[model samples]
Target: MTLDDLFSAAREAMAKTHSPYSKFPVGAAILTEDGRVFTGANIEVVSFPEGWCAETTALGHYVMGGGGRITDICVTAERLDECTPCGGCRQRLAEFAPPDARVHLTDQAGITKTITMVDLLPLGFKTEILST
Candidate 1:
């Protein structure tokens, strides 16, 4: 899928964000290697820690749909340049997306920049990192 399409999906998902607490709505869309796209919005809970991030939610949707090998990802929030994934989300994404997979960050204005998964998490842990 094109970056424009991915960003559009993310924007649409952002409209469904349930961030009553922080009001910091965010959205994410992931493109599978098979050309399928999955989108998700951030959901906040009263418990605070129960809040779910957009990236994680998108990944869950992808997995539930039997998708594999994410080829690209787009994230949108109040500010495009500032919509980078958190450390935990970065690691989670690394589990599914290859190091060379593109990650687009965008907002209402437009796409801010694109970076590879490895650029987001240079030292992501892998199964091989754990010696038997």
Candidate 2:
């Protein structure tokens, strides 16, 4: 799907968030190399640690549905600046997305900041050590 359409998909997923806990909803759109778009929303749990981020949720689903490479990604929250993925998420994303994958952050004005995985995760540690 196109960028606009992808954003819409993420927004739709955000609407389905069950956030009675913190009310800080997050949405994510994962684009696959096969041109498939998977969207996910943050699902908070009473046990905070059990909660899974929308990005990881989507990525997990993608991984289960047959392995595919990620093309680009977009993360959105009530406030875009506050929506950046955590370090764990950045590494998880780097697992599938290319170093130059575009990571978009949708802002309040509907504008977005385009960044690459390398920029967001410089010197990111992959499984290279484990493989070696």
Candidate 3:
């Protein structure tokens, strides 16, 4: 699917976020290698660390649904305009998505930007390094 399609899906998913703490509703959509899309919205908890991020939520669903090897990912957040994933999220995404996995960001006003994992997390470490 095109980036526009991904952004649209991510934006729709963002509508379901339950982030009352930060009021930073965010969503994520992951496209599997098989062309299936999985979406998720951020869920916040009273304790910050207990909260779940949109990217992890979506990837977890893909794993539970027997889907792995994500090819691309799109993220949207009104409060996070042009904001990329945090360090933890970048590695989390890298674990499932390939080196070329793409991430899309969008604002509430619909301004969108596309970036690859490499751009978000340069010199990313891979599992292969562990085996070496």
lDDT of each: 0.89, 0.81, 0.80
Give the residue spans of candidate 2 off by over 4 A.
80-82, 109-111
Q: Which stretches of candidate 1 lie over 4 Å from their true place?
A: 130-132
Sorted by TM-score (best first), the order is 1, 2, 3
Error of 3 at 92 (Å): 0.1
Q: In candidate 1, residue 22 scores what lDDT?
A: 86
Question: What does the lDDT come to for candidate 1?
Answer: 0.89
Q: For candidate 2, give the lDDT of residue 55.
A: 89
Best by lDDT: 1
Residue-wise lDDT of candidate 2 within 59-95, one digit each (tens)? 8777887757777888888745536888888998888
Candidate 3 lDDT:
0.80
Give a tens-digit lDDT track for model 3, residues 39-131: 888899999869988888888888888886677788878776876776788988887777777777777655367778877887777778899
RMSD of each: 1.6, 1.6, 1.9
Model 2: residue 115 alpha-carbon error in angstroms:
0.2
* Model 2 whole-model lDDT (C-alpha atoms): 0.81
